[model samples]
Target chain A: AQSVTQPDARVTVSEGASLQLRCKYSYSGTPYLFWYVQYPRQGLQLLLKYYSGDPVVQGVNGFEAEFSKSNSSFHLRKASVHWSDSAVYFCVLSAQGTGSKLSFGKGAKLTVSP
Target chain B: GPKVLQIPSHQIIDMGQMVTLNCDPVSNHLYFYWYKQILGQQMEFLVNFYNGKVMEKSKLFKDQFSVERPDGSYFTLKIQPTALEDSAVYFCASSPWDWGDTQYFGPGTRLLVL
Candidate 1:
């Protein structure tokens, strides 16, 4: 059973502050990892994805994530968060040969206070 | 930029009523998927369709739930005789291919079954 775990259910940060959202996954093999952001009343937008090669992947809006094989984790980070960055972030896992069925984590709601 | 679109942003229906959620996937996408997310919960994979057949379905996909993409038209998820537990935001996604391809998601359809 492939699954993703987002430890932080909610996070509050001041504008211009750095942000890090933790995500861990349980999968027997190397899985495709993705970070998706859902804005209020909007569809999910892919932030980034990691399948292999580079551990650190860049995403839209200056967001990035590092895939740690040893930790079984893919953590999203931003050097500075703007108010527009306030959204729900989801860590998703998709195993190979499974038709790309995604397993999502309980999203972390980010609130960037100005 | 390619994007997916969903019809009926929100729907309120009584239990035992039937509901059909429509998804207009990307123009060239070949794989379509459905996911369900209950309030404050992680999104769960419902089913994946390719080549006019279901490729995979998670355990959460009940017997009453069905998916089809008739005539290369909108990918649809139909739930017959819905139950209270069936209430959730249903998301539609599509990918060009299956091997770690990026899946573009549509704005979810929020379903409330009373």
Candidate 2:
């Protein structure tokens, strides 16, 4: 069975600091990866996704993710963070021919400190 | 921007009761999904419905669970004889066409079973 793992349950960083959220996936074939952010009392917002081609994919809010096939990892990164960036981040995986069903990680709660 | 709406943001019910969770997916979307998230736990995929039929369902989708989109109305997830274990947050999502495409998620409906 394909699965996604986000090792960190929570991460705290000061505003303007660099941020990285690690995500590792287990699948036998090429996997579709995505990063989604959920604000308090709000639905999830897509941050970025990786299907093919470029290993580094840029997304909204200055967020980007790097997909490494050898590592089976797609880590999200931002050069600088803002307080508004504090939210729960989920890493999702979809295998080929799954018909839109996504496997989500436990999620990493990021808190931007002042 | 597309959005998905879920009615009854919160619901409190007793065990063995029937609960219906309503979801209004993006108007142009063709695929709908349901996910369950227990407090402090990872969100788990429940089922996906497309073109008025179930496309795929996960192991978490219990026999008590059913989904329907009647007359192109709100997509609904019904839990018959709801169990205590069913107390969780349910999120509804939809995608435009392909299963590997991005999905828009709802704010989620929190169900409390006592």
Winning model by DockQ: 2
Instruction: Give the Cα RMSD of candidate 2.
Output: 0.7
* Alpha-carbon shift of residue A27 in model 1 (angstroms): 1.0
> What C-alpha lDDT do the candidate models reach, one value each?
0.93, 0.95
Off by over 4 Å in 2: none
Q: How does candidate 1 fare on TM-score?
A: 0.97
- Per-residue accuracy of model 2 over A1-81 as CA lDDT, tens digit each: 899999999999999999999999999899889999999988998998999999999999999999999999999999999
- TM-score, per-candidate, Cα-based: 0.97, 0.98
> How would you encode candidate 1's per-residue C-alpha lDDT over A11-78 as one tens digit per residue?
99999999999999999899999999998888898999999998999999999999999999999999
Q: Pick the candidate with the highest lDDT.
A: 2
Location of the lowest summed lDDT over 10 successive residues in candidate 2 chain A: A94-103
List model 1 lDDT by residue over B1-114, tens digit each: 578999999999999999999999999999999999998888988999999999988899999999999999999999998999999999999999985888899989999999
Go through the candidates in order and give each one's DockQ.
0.83, 0.86
